[model samples]
Target: MSVLLPPYAEALGVVAERDDNGRLVLAMDFAAHVRGRPGFLHGGAIAGLLELAAIATVQDRLGSDDRPRFKPITVTTDFMRGGRDKRTYAAAVISRLGSRLANVESFAWQESEDTPIAAARLNFLLARATGSPNR
Candidate 1:
């Protein structure tokens, strides 16, 4: 499906790219626009980026003409370290796929391969392909 990102996400410098395994990779470069405490990235901004990445992964897997509207059922985020002024990557994995709901877990990391900056667990209620809300 043709998914057009929101203007706000675009303006924040979030870029959605695909990896070799077809996983959706959402990335953003640190700038003054998203600073939380001086040089650190904002928590909300990270959460937003993670959520966007998770939603996009679900969409990419669901296929064309299928809109997956995710309501943040519950998200527990752990800030492993301060997100520095560098490009950050967010990756999502579908943990459980059901007919009504899907559970996803995502991780955020800086360029360093040795450490993860943050991680999050997202529970999303997946609507039917016809756009029917889960009951």
Candidate 2:
């Protein structure tokens, strides 16, 4: 199954792929459209990547379009360093999934995963899909 990212993610050229561990990883190539300052990726773009990664993680977990819906309740992003003009990667993990809420943490990095360019925490409100078997 694949996660259906929004149009904004398409505009950002976000690509989803499986890492060596068979985990979801989101990637974006740096372009003029995604540049902010002289040579750095736009802050908005980084935040967008984080957000999309989170949504993708949740959607991939649910595994189907007919699964429950998750709506972002709050998002907090931290910028650690400027993203250079290169391919950037992001990965997210669900910290907690509950009947009514979910917490996800995403990190964006370039060159090294240990050194993150940015990170984000997202809270989502979960709504059960009508007549769905999976919770």
Candidate with maximal lDDT: 2
Model 1 agreement with the true structure over 9-115: per-residue lDDT tens digits: 78778888877976678899999887899889999888878877778877778877666666678898888999998999998889987656778888888976368
**Which regions of candidate 2 are displaced past 4 Å?**
129-135
My TM-score estimates for the predictions, one after another, are: 0.87, 0.90
Report residue 61 deviation for candidate 2 (angstroms): 1.1
User: Ten consecutive residues with minimal summed lDDT in candidate 1?
Assistant: 126-135
Tens-place lDDT digits, model 2, residues 60-118: 88778545676788999999999999999999989997767789999999999999999
Displacement of the residue 123 alpha carbon in candidate 1, Å: 0.5
Over 4 Å off in model 1, which ranges? 1-3, 128-135
TM-score of 1: 0.87
